[model samples]
Target: MHTLSQLRSGKLKGIKRLDLSCGLTTFPEDIFSLADSLEILNLSGNALSSLPDDLPRLKSLKVIFCSDNQFDHLPEVLGRCSNLCMVGFKANQIQTVSAAALPLELRWLILTDNQISHLPAELGQCHALQKLMLAGNQLQSLPETLAACQNLELIRISANQLQALPDWLFSLPKLAWLAFAGNPFCPMPPASPHAPAIHWQDLEVAEQLGEGASGVIYKALWQQENPRAVALKRFKGALTSDGLPQCEMAACIAAGEHPYLIGAIGQVEHPDQHPALLMPLIDGFSNLAGPPSLESCTRDIYAQDQYFSLENTLKIASSIAAAAEHLHAAHILHGDLYAHNILIGPENETRLGDFGAASFYTPEQNLLQNIEVRAFACLLEELLSRTQGSAATLDKLANLQISSAQVTISARPLFSEIKKILSSL
Candidate 1:
């Protein structure tokens, strides 16, 4: 841990990685030239307004953490870093990204909590890019060029000024996880499902996992025979929408005994007449919506020593697909499917949870009438969000050959298959 004053002379040649977060106000000149062999550098918690122009000279540099700085613009020299893959510039004053300033081999680029209002179209040239975060910016639009990135998996643009999402954004093939909360273009609709209620005195609540449109989930220690840990989902009376309780109950029962599905332990009715569900607690899991702040996503991803791996994402997708197939086979429809509803368990096991909007269908029912088009559109949006930027994967996920007007057919078969099973029943 070196300070700005100590780094003035560039005497730390032996150090492969350096951190100058203590009382630093500016970056020393020729810092990168001196540290030719540096692989990682941390200059967070500083007052620097901009980076040195010759920063790309550090050919061995791979990772850079410059969060909490005062940078209003990204350094033009960043494009020269051929070996750089990860760059964190969260909590800065940046307002835009120039197309020419992006590195070609960059895999992960985070610029959360900045003032960015637009993205350059040339960013599409970064074919090797995988994850790009621009949360907490002033962005009202996105570049259409992002469709060129074939390997891109995650693109977070939450809490911005976007009023309408571009049509091409939904066409990315490999794009998987997305969060656009607090955006006027895709506001959290008033159509949220109802949540069951739980009294404070009935169960001992531990840590709060998160809150959703329907209810709050808590890691609780139930006072049972063995005193086991479980996830307690409690609903707020005011937030309860029509048919939510019955839908949730049906989903819990229909999910049944699938390994990838979270087992419903039991249900408890409170004095207030609200119902809550109890299930085994799965650790190290987080919702895909992430945090409301884009800076939070950048900080989490840049902390590579602590974040989830790409392999974990694949496991989650596989498990969710399996669970959805099971529901389809049982003549049940998971009315909602997104990252927030999926959980990652021990040994990277993906478990599907939150069945608040699930429903059962019969052969006589029309698929178009039975499934809410708005809800189905939301699910398709979620799936398309994941496949964005990868033409091949997008084609596979959306099956573009089916035509945009008939995209609903992808989900129609699931219900059609279920209807056939119910006919025999």
Candidate 2:
């Protein structure tokens, strides 16, 4: 949030980071004054449409964000920044992406909420790439060259015009997290009769519980024959990185009942036509970890002091495995299978929530299910990293992690097999 006045007065000289959002329509030349120190620059929420040709003068710059701007294309000068690896231009009108605009050291790239319909084949040259966010775009297809990016771990291609899923995407060894719900291949499920619809008037909304990219949840009272406390979720109805909120609710309903799942009890009939869901209130529960940070890119962040006993970690892992098994059995893909989406109770009781990235698939689509196995493996690795102690159970868990992350997708064990092994441990 640095002001133009401070920058103009040279008060921000030698700073390692700079943020200017005062309706900037052009690159501030003064920024180059801190080239020796600046590492991160954020010009989001501005009117900028381009950058100077010599943006590479900032030798120390490593990360840059120009989101919520008026750029029609990513600046080619950005590619010249030798150290820049992370680039974000979310919520812009960018449609063209030049081969020269992508940096060689690129690791994380975010182009969410853009009008991009195509990507350059040179994107495959980013050997260090890890995370990619291209949701809410007009892309009809992705370049086949992207298959060369073996380091890619997380990708968001939901809410696009893709007609089919790329077969090569499922072969990426490191790919774990994926979201592709609101596309031609995958769509919101048809209405289900199993989930009873509760009218809006029957819900007495209380305090908001929390919110995510797709919707907001609140504590409420179901005003029925015997009023009972419940949780209500109201969809935002906008395109998110994971896809549309309706798809999330549809998948949640289709998921049905499972002990480890935060299954929807009923659908909400809002008078104003707002999409919502009702479920039993979860008492005494909290997230297992925080979402990833800028540096971590796609990994969850656990508390510094957080440590789990081998037994408890195994218990938590088993619960999530069972939940995933049930989801796969119902032809649902929990695109997001991270610990951050899991709520933990006092006795290590885990309830997997947040179906915002869930998508429906047919039985023949082993690619979707097997890709999720990599995600499950990632979760197991995270938990095993935090658990301390030595036992036969620990060795078995380690072996399971390796088997689940096998390079050959077919070699990876299914969630059911993982669940059985964990239960035995």
Candidate 3:
């Protein structure tokens, strides 16, 4: 969060990070003074539409974020940076991406909430690309050359115009987390006619609980239900990178109830017709881990001092797997099943939540469930890295990870089977 005054006064010299949000319409020449050391640069919330062609002079720059800007196209000068690997230009009006706009060593790229209809074929040349976000766009199809990116792990292509899923996309060896919910390939699910409706007038809002890409959760009291304290999520009522708020609320209602899932009491009937959910207030529970960092693009970053026993970790993992199995049986896919979304209670009670990425499917859509299994494997792998348990126990988890992450969809074990394996440990 360094200010322009500090940067101009040379007080931020030798710093590895610089964040400027002072309504700049042009690149600051003073930024070059710290070129030798700056590794992360954030210039979001500005009016700039382009970057200086000499951006490569910042030889150490590796990550750049220019989200919420006025850029109509990605800057082509980015490709000249030798060490640049992570580039984010979200929420822009980008309609075209030139062939040279991609970096050579790119690993993570976020072009979410844009108007891109086509991608440059040269994107396939980035052998190191691991994570990509292009959810809210008008893309009719993906570039076939993207199949060459064998290292790509997580991708979000929701809310797009794709009429069909590319067959070769399933063959990507490292793809684990995928969101293609609000697209043409998958038609919108019908609203649940049986779910209860709780009017907004019958509730009293309290303190804010938390917020995410989809909405804001708040602590509230249901005046009509014995004044019970509950959680209420008021959606942003706009299209997010994953998809629409209506779809997420519908998925939550369709998920019904499960021991390891957050209880969705009903939908809020508001005068404004804003989508909202009435849920059970999870007391004393917190996220098990934080979202991934710029460096660890696809991995969860747990608290450094937080340690969980192997038994507790296995219990949590089993609970999540059981809940996922329930969803699969209901023909629902919990697309964003990661530790960052799991709530950890004092006694290791687990509840898998956040239906923003959940989507409905038919019993015949077996591949989708297997795809979620890979996400479970990622969580299991993260837990394994945190625990140094018995040789046999560790070896068992290692093998389960292998089965869950099998690039071949059929080779991955069913969530039910994975639950059994975790229970045994």
Candidate 4:
């Protein structure tokens, strides 16, 4: 939230990052003054429509965020910035993307909630690309050139006009996280009859539980005959990087009941008709790890000193595997199977949460399940890296990790098989 006055006065010089969001309409020339030190520039929540041609003068810039702006097209000069690797232009009027706008060293690109209908084939030139966010756009199909992105790990194509996903996407060497709900090819499953409707007036909202990209969660008290404490999730009614909150709600309901999954107890519709979910309140739990950092890119960040007992590691992995098997049986893909989404409770209990990236798939699309297997493998590998136990038990877990991460999608063991093998160990 740095102001133009402070920037113009040169008081913010020698900074590695700069954030300006005071209704700016044009690029500030003073920004170039910190070109030697500025590595990140955030101009989100502004009125800017374009950047100056000399934006490349910021030679140290590695990331730039211009979300919630008025840009209609990506700036071509971005391609000339050799050091720039991450670009975020979400929620803009961007309808055109020139091939020259893509940096060759790009690792992450976000163009969500835009009017983009086509993408330049030159995207294939970005061999280092990993994370791509393109939800809430008008894209009907992806360029086949994207298949060359072998390092790509996560992608979001939800809320787009996509007719079908390319088969090659399912075989990417590193592809793991994926979401494609709200597209023509993937219709959400019908509302679950098992999730009974609970009037919002019957619950008393308490302190906030937490918030994520799509919604706000709170602790609530269900004021029924047998009153009980419950968790309430009220969607923000906006398109997230994953997809619509409504789509997530649909996936949560479709997921039904599972021992390791956070199930929806009832559906809630406020007097104004805002949709919400009543869930069983989870007590005394914490996230297994933090989300990926700028350096880790696609991996979760665990505590440096964190170490799990071999028995606890096996239990956590087994619980998650059983839950994943259940989800696949119900024809659902938990697009995000990362450690950060797994909440660890007392006695080594684990519960998988966050349906924001979940999507429905047919049983025939086993490749999708295989893609998730790679994610599960990564989770297992992370746990193994933190555990020390009997060589035999550790060897078994390592074997499962290796088999689950096989480059050949069909070679990966199913969650059911993993669950069984884990139980046997």
Candidate 5:
């Protein structure tokens, strides 16, 4: 498979896979017919207009990634590949998908960054699909048949023309981690104070560190005597009330130097867009990919020893508890403190991220809302449930019980029970 012509010659009869990405500009005719054993094919970053009709001849074909291509229509022969489990057609010119174009065994379908205006009703027949990425498309509405995808966990339908999300969408039992930003269905929260401008040319962006509903974060190198690098969080919207960048900067600055907290570097406005905040970048940290539920964590770490280690789990829980304590001490309630927002860094260190929804307890807003209190209780319950039936967990539970009893109690004592569970951990 040195050249495209050679690959099309049907010489590599036993070849089970083919990757013609990065350099290939055009699809060679008869390329699909040569490799009957081909089970996986990556034709991404190519100039192909359509999939060859002979693609279904490969009996062992299981996965195909045709993203970043010039295809204007969904490949019809794909449905014939009964074993196909995953298909990625992102960043293409696909405008329509016929009802019979989708495969049955497909477990993942990525069609982001396309011109897809409607999804075929037959897509609901792909019962095994567990993940679907349809962001950055022209979808005005989702088909009612999508309710049949009982196994769907993550759905990214952001940046669409949706004026409202279907009621069934919110009813998926496994559905979590939904982001519908840039859609008329969901509106942005009120803004905050604006920050000063910072030049893009002066800052060197390193690797993309994290991403959230609002924006992306990058490790950046700033021009200074020491040339320090910091984590820069760039917000998406422009002309926000006070500006999200300023709000984040103010939160970090007020947070000060705390052992359990990531420190603030500075704040700067984008040269072209909204403002951004710079903070001490944690070297390696990740927001848990799935939901914050205990079941999700158990499923993710069932076979992974490090993830299930008692020492690692205790250390992370303790660190998060300490961080929450610090925030409460500062008269701030971390309105949204879930497993996903709690990042795990090097050496099992834990740090709380995403303070976008945090609420400051000042004279203006003295009491936390019922919803906020309930959310905190739920978070504490989840944390405690993860470390059930342990001595250290018992101790943490006792501490939470005392703390909740002493502090202002809202809703029910069940809320205190959740706090007790956290303290016991």
Candidate 6:
């Protein structure tokens, strides 16, 4: 929260980072003075529409964030920043991204909540790219050349106008987390309502437990049948990068009952009829890991103090794989299966939640399963590194992981097979 006062008094001299969000209408000319020391410049929450061409003067600058601004086009000056690899223009009005505006060394790019409709072919030239977020855009299609970016892993293209996904998009060896919901070509979930409905008038929506791109989860009291606690998730009533909320609800309902899955008891019924889920309130559990950071673009960041015992590691992996296999048998693909999405209880009990990126596909689509297998392998590999299991036990998990992560999509073992190996261990 750098202030104009300190910046003017030379009090912030030689700082490596600068955050000036005072609702300014233009870029402060004084920023150029820190060109020698500034590595990150965050000018978010401003009214700026463009950047000065001399932005390259910050020769060491590595990151630039201009979110919540009025920029209609990605700044062309950014291409000249030899060291700038991370750029964020989220919640801006950006509609055009010039080819020259992208740097070849760019790794992470965020353009969420923009009005962009097309991308330049030069995007494929960014071979070093890893994470790309273009959710909430008007992208009709992706350039086929992007398949050349083999290092690319995580991608969010939900809530877009994509009519179809490219074949190459799914075959990328490193693609672990991907969401392409809300597209015209996505499959419609089958009609099946196993979970019953609970009227909204019976429960009070209280303090929010958490929120995601698709919906908000809240802790509520169910006063109708049981005067006990429950978790209520109300959809945002808008298309997300993963797809429609109704689709997620449908998957949850069709998912049936599984001990490892978060219990979805029913749906929410209201006069306004907002799609919501009634779930068991889980306690004494925490996320197993955090979302990937800028540096670990495609991998999760587990807590430094968090390490699992050999038995606990196997138990967690077995539970998640069983749940995944169950979903597969139901023809549902849990598109986002990263470890960060897992919840761990005090006794090492595991539960799988978050259907935001889940999708329904035919059993014949073996490639879809293969794509998810890569994610499972990545999760297992992470667990393998964090455990102190015996050499034999470690060897078995490693072999299963290797088979799951096979580069040849056709060569990867089914989750059922992977589960067998894990269960035996």
Which residue pairs clash in candidate 2? none
C-alpha lDDT of all candidate models, in order: 0.60, 0.89, 0.87, 0.91, 0.63, 0.84
**Cα lDDT for residue 134, candidate 5:** 80
Flag regions of model 5 displaced more than 4 Å: 1-15, 22-26, 33-36, 194-196, 201-228, 232-277, 284-308, 315-343, 352-420
Candidate 4 residue-wise lDDT, 1-425, digit = tens: 78889999999989998999999898989999998999999999999998998998999999999999999999898999999999999999999999999999999999999999999999988999999999999999998899899999999999999988778796687888999999999987777777777887898999999987778999999998899999999887678778987788888888888889987786787898787878889999999999998768899999999899999999999999989999899888899999999999989899998988888988778779989999999999999999999999999899999999888888888998998899998
Model 2 root mean square deviation, Cα atoms? 2.0
* Model 3 alpha-carbon drift over 4 Å, by segment: none
Clashes of each: 14, 0, 0, 0, 11, 3
Best by lDDT: 4
Per-residue lDDT for 117-216 in model 2, tens only? 9999999999999999998899999999999999998888988999988988977998888888889988667798878769898878999999987788
Per-residue lDDT of candidate 1, residues 1-425 (tens digit): 77555566657765677887765566676466555678888888888877776787777887788888888888767888888877888778997678666887788888877889888888888887777777668898888888788666456565678875555544554443444444674323222133333344657888888787568889998765566677888775322321245346545754667888885765665667676777778778654443222223221121223334434433444565567667656655554455456665567677777775454544433342222222323333444544334455445435421222243323433433332322332
- Candidate 5's displacement at residue 409, Å, is 26
Q: Using lDDT as the measure, name the better of candidate 1 and candidate 3.
A: 3
True-structure Cα RMSD, model 4 = 1.3
Compared with the true structure, what per-residue lDDT tens digits does model 6 show for residues 259-293? 99985777678688677888888899888899777
Candidate 6: lDDT of 263?
53
For candidate 3, which ten residues in a row score worst on lDDT? 237-246
Candidate 2 runs further than 4 Å off: 235-237, 270-275
What's model 4's overall lDDT?
A: 0.91
Better of 3 and 4 by lDDT: 4
* Residue 357, candidate 4: C-alpha displacement in angstroms: 0.8
Which portions of model 4 miss their true places by more than 4 Å?
none
Pick out the ten consecutive residues of candidate 4 with the lowest summed lDDT.
188-197
TM-score of every model versus the real structure: 0.55, 0.94, 0.95, 0.97, 0.65, 0.92
